[model samples]
Target: MALTADSPLTELLQENPKAAEILMRFGMGCVGCALASGETIRQAAEGHGIPLPELLEALGIEE
Candidate 1:
C-alpha cells in the first residue's frame, strides 16, 4: 500500500523498513516507540516539529 500522511507509523515501517533511516535522519526516534503503533506519520511530524512535506519527500512518499 502506498504511504500517506494518515499512514500509521507501524504500518509505514512494515511497508518500508528503509523509512526508519529517513525518519531517524529527520530526528524522529519514534520508530521504536510504543506510540508508533497508533501515531500517524502526520502526527509524528507535528510532534517533532518537522514539516510534513519535507518528511514525506524524504520518505519518497508523494503527498
Candidate 2:
C-alpha cells in the first residue's frame, strides 16, 4: 500500500513487515515505541531526517 503521514504505523507494520527495513534503514528503529506506534511513514522519515523520495523508494512506494 502507498503510505502517507496519516497511515498508522501499527497498521502499516502489520501489513508490511518490509516497512521496518525501510524505516530502520533511515535510522528509525523504534518501531515498538509508543511514539512510533502512532507515527506515520512521512512523519517518521522526517523525524529521521530521511529524504522523502529516498524513503519512498526504499519502501517500494512511488513518490
Candidate 3:
C-alpha cells in the first residue's frame, strides 16, 4: 500500500524502515511505542509539534 500522511505509524514503519530514522530525527520516538498501532502519521506529527507537511516530505509520503 502507498504511504500517506493518514497512514498509521505501524503501517508507515512497516512500509519504510527508513521512516523510523526520519521520525526519530524529528524527535518522534513512536517507533516502538504502543500507540504506534493506532496513531496516524498526521496525529503523530501534531502530537510531536512537527509540521505535518515536513514530516510527510521526510517520510516520502503524500499528504
Candidate with top TM-score is 1
Segments in model 3 whose C-alpha atoms lie over 4 Å from true places = none
Q: Of the pair 2 and 3, which is ahead by TM-score?
A: 3
The deviation in Å at residue 5 for candidate 3 is 0.8
Task: Decide which is better by TM-score, 1 or 3.
Answer: 1
Q: What does the lDDT read for residue 26 in candidate 1?
A: 94
lDDT, candidate 1, 1-63, per-residue tens: 788999889989899999999999999876798877889999999999999999998988877
RMSD of each: 0.9, 1.9, 0.9
What TM-score, over all chains together, does every model reach?
A: 0.92, 0.78, 0.91
**Overall lDDT per candidate, in order of appearance:** 0.90, 0.77, 0.85
Give Cα distance to truth, residue 16, candidate 3, Å.
0.6
Give candidate 2 regions above 4 Å deviation: none
Query: What overall lDDT, based on C-alpha atoms, would model 3 receive against the true structure?
Result: 0.85
lDDT of 2 by residue, 1-63 (tens): 665555777877887887787777778879879998878777877887888778777776665
